[model samples]
Target chain A: MPYGYIASMKARPGHRDEVIDILTGGADGLRTAGCHLYVVAAATTDDVTIWVSEVWESKQHHDDSLKLPEARAAIAQAMPLLTGEFFTQETEVRGGLTGQP
Target chain B: MPYGYIASMKARPGHRDEVIDILTGGADGLRTAGCHLYVVAAATTDDVTIWVSEVWESKQHHDDSLKLPEARAAIAQAMPLLTGEFFTQETEVRGGLTGQP
Candidate 1:
């Protein structure tokens, strides 16, 4: 089964857009590192929170991607803009439309 | 921008699979109703909790889907199997790979 997770983070008071930019900037590298899905989203009703929904080929693939140079750099840049509040739910990809058909 | 959300629900003890089945079974109808993505997943460390990550063409599309007969039926069937615990975060789909062009 594929590995997946939905993670949410809060950006510093006025830096949500900057944080989102950095988070989304590493997608190409993530795809090459075995990510099947990497979606960055922001709550419609909340300005400081951002949600990332990801599907990786495996848990190991996800872990390895975090070690990639670009990934680490992006994370470092975004971390300063974030509030340190986070939420994550690790999941086993069951099944449904992923637009992969 | 696309409309999306990550919703988590807790199934009644031992009824998680049944709920997942019903939730995933409505995919065909949802696609036709303008859903871009609908992924059913279960937390690896929590057997009774199920997470559904979805992206629709628009918020209207998502709202319309819930009124579909098939969707209503599936919800009705799954509700009894659920514990009524739910978490929902509505989002504005920013961007990334969704396995779509």
Candidate 2:
């Protein structure tokens, strides 16, 4: 089964957009690293929270992606801008519509 | 901007599959109702929680879908199997990969 998670993180008060940019900027590397889906979104009712929903070819793929140079760099850059508050729900992707966004 | 949310609902014990069936069964109509993506997932570490991640052309499209006959039927059928526990996070989709799942 495909591995996935929907997670949220809070950015330092004025850094949400910068954090979002850093997160979304690594999409190309993620795709080549075996990602099936990677969506970055903003919490509609808040200014500092961001949500990311991702699906990977496998759990191992997801783990490995985090170790990739681009991925690590992105995370490092965003960490300082974040507040360390996070929420995550790991999931097994059963089925769904893809490619329409 | 595209509208989306990642929401989770808990099923009654031993009824997760039934609830999943009911939820995924409505995909066809949801697509016709202007859904861009509709993913039904199972929580990796739990048996009763089901996660649904969706993106619609507009919030109105999502609202209209819940009023569709099929949608209502599905909801009615699944409610009895649910625990009433739910979590929802509304989002404004920024950018990411789609259609690869």
Candidate 3:
């Protein structure tokens, strides 16, 4: 199964929409660069923060995407709007044996 | 193997330590309620965001902790200091299958 990487980030006050726009633009950037899936959800009560749940075919695919030109440049554009920091983990999927699949 | 629940919270400015304190207090409360482990890490770069990585012996253990009176009460005290949303996930450990164990 493909591994998953979840990254959660919060935007600076008044900059959430711009951040989302930039993230939206990265859809294609992510796909072409090797991302298998990427989903972003704004907090129901707090719009400034967004949780990005992403997946790649494998750890190698994820690492490869980070070095992609578009991914790096897009990250540069989005990093400043963040007020705090982000948490990310490289997780192995046990979804199959768990019977969820 | 145990399951893990990762919760990432961003505290309001100046409230990070307070939040961590609340969480720390939950350590005993969690273990008694069936948690196997609970660890909190303050972001190295952002003082306001903290990532809490927790493990329960099983899914039932995690669910039971939520209903613990201490757990509920502690959340009430800590919720207000949060400036944005939190991301929580219940995940199975595929470490064994992934050759990490």
Candidate 4:
């Protein structure tokens, strides 16, 4: 099944832009690595909260992506900008731009 | 530009599946109406929280979609299952399977 995931991150005060850049900057690479959708969105009502919505070819594709060198590097850079609070959702993508439709 | 949005909803206790169904059941019609991606994801750690990640042809497409009869009906069906607390993110979807890639 396709892997659908949403990860909510809180950036430290004044670090929202930096975190968004980090997330978007890595998008091309993630796409090349099998992510069908990699959206980086900032919450409209909360300046410090950013949401990442992703659709991967499979659960393994997503899990394996975190171990990629580029991903590891990006995470290291983004970690400092975050406040360490995150809300994650992992769902079996039933359809839509996930190529499941 | 493509319209990307994420709306987080809290389903009343034991109503998560119902919300997910209401969200997913509307997918086919929405897709036919210009929604490129409409993913229904339930939070892994929070059983009552559901996240909808959407990509529409444009912001107008998304806004207009809410006025569709099918969408209107779905909202009416879902409102009672929700807690009225929602977090929304509206972003300029730069690229991805949103077809902007």
Local distance difference test, each candidate: 0.87, 0.88, 0.64, 0.79
Candidate 2 deviant stretches above 4 angstroms: none
lDDT value, residue A13 of candidate 4: 96
Tens-digit per-residue lDDT, B10-92, candidate 4? 99999988888888887877876678778777666777888788877888889899999988998999999999999887865
Give the alpha carbon lDDT tens digit for every residue of A1-101 in model 4.
66788888899999998888877876777776778777777666667888788888888899999999988998999999999999887876654443224
Error of 1 at A67 (Å): 0.3
Q: Which has the better DockQ: candidate 2, or candidate 3?
A: 2
lDDT of 4 at B63: 89
TM-score ranking, high to low:
1, 2, 4, 3
Once fitted onto the true fold, the runs of candidate 3 whose alpha carbons sit more than 4 angstroms away are: A1-101, B96-101
Off by over 4 Å in 1: none
Q: Which residue pairs show collisions in model 4? A: none
RMSD of each: 1.3, 1.4, 11.5, 3.5
Poorest 10 consecutive residues by lDDT, candidate 2 chain A: A92-101
iRMS per model, in Å, is: 1.6, 1.2, 11.8, 3.6
Ranking by lDDT: 2, 1, 4, 3
Q: Per-residue lDDT for A8-67 in model 2, tens only?
A: 999999899999899988786677889988888899998999999898899999999899
Q: What is the per-residue lDDT of model 1 for residues B1-101, given as tens digits with 9 covering 90 to 100?
A: 99997899999989998888888886866777888888899998878999999999999999988888888888899998999989998999888788744
For B9-96, candidate 2 gives per-residue lDDT tens digits of 9999999988888888768666778998888899988899999989889899999989988988989999999989998988999888
lDDT of 2: 0.88
- Model 1's interface RMSD: 1.6
lDDT of 4 at B82: 94
The residue pairs in collision within model 3 are none
